[model samples]
Structure formats: structure tokens, C-alpha cells
Target: MRVKPLYFFTILLLFSSLNNAYAFCGFYVAKASSDLFNQSSQVVMVRDGSRNIVTMSSDFKGNVNEFAMVMPVPTVLKREQIHVTDNKIIEHLDSYSAPRLVEYFDENPCSPPVMYKMMPMAAPAMKSDSATVKKRARSLGVTIEAQYTVGEYDIMLLSAQQSGGLLTWLTEQGYKLPQGADAVVGSYLKQKMKFFVAKVNLKKFNQSGYTRLRPIQIAYDYSRFMLPIRLGTVNSQGQQELFIYALSRQGRIETTNYRTVKLPSEIEIPSYIKTQNKFADFYRDMFRTQVKKQNNKAVFLEYAWDMNWCDPCAADPLSNKELRELGVFWVNEASNKPQISQRRRPPQQGQNVYLSRLHVRYDRHNFPEDLLFQNTANRENFQGRYIIRHAWKGTEQCNAANQYFKSLTKRQNQRAKNLSNLTGWNINDIQKTMQIPQRSASSSNEDMWWKDLWSQ
Candidate 1:
């Protein structure tokens, strides 16, 4: 009886050693996809039949997890498992409505940050055992990044971007207020503030049909690229508070209620625009700081926004003469709300209706070109003489958008090289190359077209 009990204990110990050496048994990788939100790349995981959990997401636990066929890549499997592998790549569980679970496609995926989740169950023991070596292995930091860029847009929406930018314009013009001081104050403060909303509307759609692709659309795409957002606010005490949100593949999740307050300021608009002293510039600067310092391990950068802090901007105390010329955007004045034609609407509804002139009217010649150009004017102005801020609405469309870390892919770069093969894009005529989408509609326009040789 004593010998039998000892023999049983000895056999169990041997089995346990063998099991530790080999790893997980029976449980398989149920499903895997890339586009799913909240994804991980450092490790794979699965669940056991009796509701026990297993994981592949790990740095060595002083034991080899991969050897146990844990979340093994399809390439490592035998022919019998090929069909299962194909199913994983092609199908998913509860993926349709779950944005986090969809396998996002990217020629280049973001270097998502390392994520660690503890599994509650252990692997079963094996009968055979083998011994090898032991040593110290350095733990590595892992990051994952996924980007959803349907349309192309730049990655940063900074002070260098337009003042009539979505945040600016929306706060300025998008709302209707109750008739009183609270509403007035809200309207006044909103215009100077900034923040990235989860949903963005291409508000200019009705205004620009053939004139150009609406800039709000570009801004929308730009936001999705995990572009940084800056918000400026002011408190009643004339204190400035800037909220900056960083873009990650995950949505902007900040620990503070920094986004909802007002920050007071004593700053001038034109002078402020001239300098990078605007509140939004704070987060914009932080964004440059973060992206410039992104580690090599590509992490999923899903949705990131940034903000800037500020006191309510100082009030303009200019006389009527100065307001008329340098600042025609008179607060005492009203903005004209032009009516739209059916051409602006989509093909489906009310397309047959004739357009109406906007009920509002104002003197175009008296327009504040200076105010509009205070932040928007540039040497890189593409449209004939007029930029987007002020002018007869342009007929030429401007569509500049992008996705992922940067816009230029190896394939895109190759296509760029092959570009000369397909068309007469003369490399020698440096001043006259067209960057598709809005290519030269006329001979003279060719000389004015601009294309950046680089994108991120």
C-alpha cells in the first residue's frame, strides 16, 4: 500500500513537469481578425471547453507558451488545420456591429502599446517530460496601432490649420441659441473654444458642390487619422484652461474633465493668430511632441484628438474704423445665411426642387478679407488668388486626405515612380506637375498646381 501511493505521487510529478514543458492542450484559437477595436498583437489567446480561459498575450512566463500550440499562426499548423485558419481570416464572431472586433485592414498597422491580461486557468498535465536550458530574457515593451482612413487627410489639425476649422466654425455658426445673455455668452465662448467631437458633419456640403470637395469632409477624414485636437477655454475669473487630447487607435479617453470648461484669456485675435499663442496651439504642440516620439514598435492608433488651454481671449477694443478695415467681422453685425439649391443635396431627396437664394444679404466688397486671412492666408495658397476663407466660392475642388501613420506607402511610392510611365508628368518641369484628383483643368492652371513629395 505504501509503495503504491509513492508510485502514484512520482508519476504525477513527472506528468506535471512534462505539461509545464509542453504547455496548453486541446483548447484552440477560436477566432482572430485585425480590424477589431481593442486589439492586441504581442500575444494570442483562447478559451477552454469547461469555461476556463487561456491566453497567448504574454512575455515568457519563464515557460514557453507558443510550443503548446497556443494561438499558433496559421503558417505553423499542419494541413488539417488550414481550413480552420482560413475561417479565422475570413469570418468573425459578433463582428458586424462591433467596431472593436472588426479586422481592420492596413498595409501598415500602428504599433499598438503593450497590453497585459491575466488568464485564470492553467494547462492540463502531460505524461512525457523533457528538460533543456534556463536563462534570463529581457522583457520587451509592445505596442499595436490600427488606423481607419477611408478618405485621405493630413494627420494634424493645428494652429497652422484654418481658424474656420470645424471646431472653430461649429462653435461659431452651428448652433441656435435661446434669446438672452446665457445663449449669447455660450455662443460667444463656443467660437473661441476647440475639441474633437466623436461625430463630425461635413457642414459645408451644401455650399460646395462643384466648387470643391467640402473642407469639413477633409477635416472629418483628418480627425479619423488620429489627428491631434486642441481646445481653448476661459473661466469667469479670466483664467485660461487648455485641454489637449492625444490620438490613439483607441478613442480619446482622458482622465480629467478638462474638455468641458471655459478658460478666460486676455489675448488679441489677429495678433494672437500671427503668433502660435492660441489655446489650441497647446495640444497641437503636444501632438507634435507625441508623434515625433512614437516608438518603433507600431501600436494601433485608432482615434486620437488633442486640445489647447486658454483664458477667454481678450476683448477687442478697436474703434469703428479699425473694426471696418482690419476686422470687418463686427460682433454687432449678423452673418448672412444663404439659401441653397437642390444641386447641393444628394441624388435621392428633393433633388427636383429649384434652389432659393439665401434670405440673408450683405455687401461682398465690405467683407473682412483681413480677418479671414488672419489665420488662413498662406504663400501656399492653391486656388487662383482667393483662399477658402474669403472669395467667390471656388469652382475648383480641393481634396487632400490620408490614413494610417503616413500617406506614402511603398506601393504608392512605386506607383509614383511608374507615374511618369503612364502620363507626361515631366520630372524636369518641377513647377508644372499635377497631383491627381484636382489636376489641371486648363493649360495655365498646370503651372500653379502643387503636390507634396511626402506624406505621413
Candidate 2:
């Protein structure tokens, strides 16, 4: 039997906007670079069995007329299978799974240990178009299989027999095919992948009266669970940052072709970082450090948790309606609630929703192939949680208080070292910045003076 070509579409838009996007499991600070080449691209992939739904949000910042996208899909999508969704849903998902910082205060060590039982914490949360005269497309060996105007996007399903022909046809039609894209396009063509191309319909966009472009959602069924990032890397500037939010019925989703490493998390850092509003910088630097440690060849898992609950939620868990809107087909409207047994009560509203946040900084040299993924049975919860422990500030003269003060100095020094190791910041500079007093060598000797005197 002949295999059918997977229809993929590319949006020809410069993804360069800064709208408080989320990266993997953390919010991409608005202050980060918003340039298309510098900013991050966000993708939400929902997989159940062989069905896959993808929602892509671009940060395109240029003339709307120049905006276009080309995506490779596994199968041709019908009008019903394609929809334009509000950007807020993507933002909500980002916020729900984002890496979070939780603050804890240390109680007075001198106080009697209150046998207070700890209560459990509650948990929280593409298109294209076509056109053309028959002669040019035919000469280029590009065929327009279908066309539709979905929402503000003019979409087209195209099949090209040759990459050179497709390139010529795209250029002839005024689509700016990036240099060095021909090889990537040729590779996809050899695999019989179809292209879905889309551009913003100015009239529709103006009529819709939306200031920014919304995300595009597409649904299809194919055995391959992968994302094509090679196109985005072609003729690109430095490394490109991509955030993938993978939702699946199974546990966490990870990259199959590359090593999927979890980001450093649940570490106690200096409390001053919170007051200094340096969490964003800290995360950025720490992420860079991890990428460097991995030799820039691994995908970092920022967060992996079930959708039912969160320890300290970054944002409220997405409702069933929101998940459905985001193209989670398995969510049943009537039975959206979790299954309850006579022995146990359900924890949250939704059931069997697992989200994996994968962040990757990629370049052509490091990521030569598209990303392949596999859903695993490992359901262990993980989050990029940074803790801030406020030191006790009591002046009590009890024996416990005295020991606490002595240990406090050691703890603070360790915190400084942790910060320096995670961010590659100078240890002395970090100490200076945090106003931490440097420990003197003489003070260390003073603590062991008896031992030193005996040895002499």
C-alpha cells in the first residue's frame, strides 16, 4: 500500500514579539530579547495514542504583509481540524506549568518544638495560503492540493516534488525563502512530507480588530511524534530558544533523539535574590550554565507534573474548557472530573493530564535533526522550584539560639557558594552584591584554637 504524505504548514512570520511568554516551565521575562532571532518560540504539543495536536505561537514583529509560515504535517488537515485559538490559553498553560519560587520562613530555634502536624499543601495548575498562476507552479513541481481561509489566516496545502522547484515557486510568489532552506526542504520532500503554508489575511485581521496575531492550532493523526525545528534554524543568527509544552495521557514526555535532562531545581538559594528581583536573571543565567554543562546537546526538562494539583501553583490549573480549546481531544465534557472511588476522593477537576515542559537552545550544529519525543510511564513529579529560607532574626540568649547563630554563618556561606556554582557568577562578587560578610581565615582558626595549641 502507498503511504500518504503528511501535510505540514509553515507560517512565514518573523516570530519576534515580547508578550510575557513562558519558556518551558518558566516565564520568559519580558525584558529578554524580543527580536525574532533572539526571542523564544512557543509550541504546545498534545499527544494521545497516534493523534497529535499542535498549537504554535510566534513572536513575529514586522510588517503583517511580510508574515508567512510553512509547516510540515503528517496528514492533510481539514478545515474543521484547523482553528485559531486565543493567545491567553497558551499563556495560561505557561503560567500553570512555569517554574516557581516559594518562600519559607525559619522559626525561632530557641522556641520549644511545637508538635504541630503539617498539613498537606494543595496543588495548583498554522496556516497558509496559496496562489498562483498554473504555469509557474507546474514548472516548479509544486502542487496546491487545497486552500481555505481559517479565521484571519489564508491557508494552503501544498505538495512539492522537488526542493529546488518549491524554492523557485516560493520565491516567484514573493515568499522570502531563507537561504540554506532548500536542503531542509529537500529532505522533507524526500520523506513525502506535505507543506501547509499560511499568511495573515490583512482584511480579516483588520476586521477581527486584534492588535496581535493569535496562535494557530492544527490536529492530525500520524505515527511520528516529532517537531521540525530545522527550518527555523536555517540561516539563523545565534542559538534559538524553543519552549515545548507537551501534554499527554502518559507521564512525562521527553526527547528521544537527544538527552533529556531535568533542570536543576528544589535548591535553597540566598534569600536576597527575592528582594533584589533577580529571580529572572538567576533563572536565565542558571539555564545558560546547564546548557553549557550539557555541551549544548541536551533538552532540559523544566517541569513535569500531573495536571490535577501543584505544590505552589504559579497560576491556576487550566479548566477543562480551556484544555479543550487548546485541542486536547480526549477531555470529555461530561466526565472531565477525575474518577472517584469509595475509598478516596478526587484531587482535582481534570483527570490523566500530564504536562512536560521542555526547553531547548538550539543551533544547526547542535540540532541537525528535528525533535523526536516519547511519552514515558515515569510519573514522578518534578518542578524547577527555588526556595528562599529567611534566616531567624531573634536575639534570644538561649543555648539553642547561640548555636543557631553559629550555624547561620555556615548556611549563608553555603548559599553563596550554591549561587556562584549555579550562575557562574564570581563568588566574591556575589558576596559583595549580597552584602554578605567575608569569613576570615583567622576566625576559622579561632574555632579550633585548642586543637592547634595542643599540636604545637
User: Which regions of candidate 1 deviate over 4 angstroms?
Assistant: 1-176, 180-255, 258-456
Model 1, C-alpha of 223: deviation from truth (Å): 15
In candidate 1, what are the lDDT values of residues 1-456, reduced to their tens digit? 111000000000001111111111111111122111111111111111111111111111111111111111101122221111111210111011011100112222232333222111111101001011001000111111111211111111111022223223322322211122133223322432112111111332233232221111110000011111110111011111111111111122222211111111111111111122222332233222332233211121211111010011011112223212211222222322222221122223211111000000011122111010001111110100000011112233333222331232322333333322222244232122323222222222223344343453
Which 10-residue window in model 2 sums to the lowest lDDT?
A: 20-29
Query: lDDT for each of the candidates?
Result: 0.17, 0.70
lDDT for 162 (candidate 2): 94
lDDT of 2 at 82: 84
lDDT score, residue 411, model 1? Answer: 28
The model with the greatest TM-score is 2
TM of each candidate vs. truth: 0.12, 0.85
lDDT of 2 by residue, 169-207 (tens): 766665656667798778877877777787789999999
How many pairs of residues collide in each model? 75, 37
Model 1, CA-based lDDT: 0.17
